[model samples]
Target: DAMVIQNPRYQVTQFGKPVTLSCSQTLNHNVMYWYQQKSSQAPKLLFHYYDKDFNNEADTPDNFQSRRPNTSFCFLDIRSPGLGDAAMYLCATSRTRDSIYEQYFGPGTRLTVT
Candidate 1:
């Protein structure tokens, strides 16, 4: 089926080390989004890519970054992994930026920091 897919569903990283999570889609959606979700908390929108344009949430930390080289691929880069940074990172896609459109989410990548 055409849908979003996240790689390395489980990730382990050392403190201060950099880790990257990847997302891809066969859906050919024009909008791609990245989110961080910690235990017992709501998913936080870190950033998104509307085609070639990048839009980041104002409150997003400098440690979080994203890259979308093309429509089919996107990546989340953690500059330095911290113990508190361990959480589920989600990737989502939408056909349009319109509020009425439904967003499709990937399974997510769980990061563990040691």
Candidate 2:
């Protein structure tokens, strides 16, 4: 069974507060990705964890970071969330880096920065 799960369907955080979003997959995929989507904008690829190697996008901000302690789990930590950070955080998994287009996405976590 291939499935991706994201905790806390909705979240609210104070401005400048740190928050974390988690994801896990039962598909045993080799690649896990984190995306950010704002209103009326397509999801932007923040980063990806692939087989013990972490890859960060060129434009990903320093305030955002990720940790993958193991293959099945990944976490996105926002060191100091700002109002601009309020958006839908998505987690996705793929069997291989080359098959990113075929990845399965989690329901997503909506973060509200107050």
Tell me how far the alpha carbon of residue 72 in candidate 2 is from the true structure, in angstroms, after superposition: 0.6
Per-residue C-alpha lDDT of model 1 across residues 25-75, encoded as one tens digit per residue: 999899999999999899999999999899999999899988898899999
Q: Which 10 successive residues of model 1 have the least lDDT summed? A: 94-103
Model 2, residue pairs in steric clash: none
Check candidate 1 and list the clashing pairs: none
| lDDT, candidates in the order shown | 0.94, 0.94
| 92: Cα error in model 2, Å | 0.5
- How many residue pairs clash per model? 0, 0
Q: Which parts of model 2 have CA positions greater than 4 angstroms off? A: 97-101
Give residue 98's error in model 2 in angstroms: 10
Give lDDT: candidate 2, residue 21: 97
What value does the lDDT take at residue 76 in candidate 1?
Answer: 97
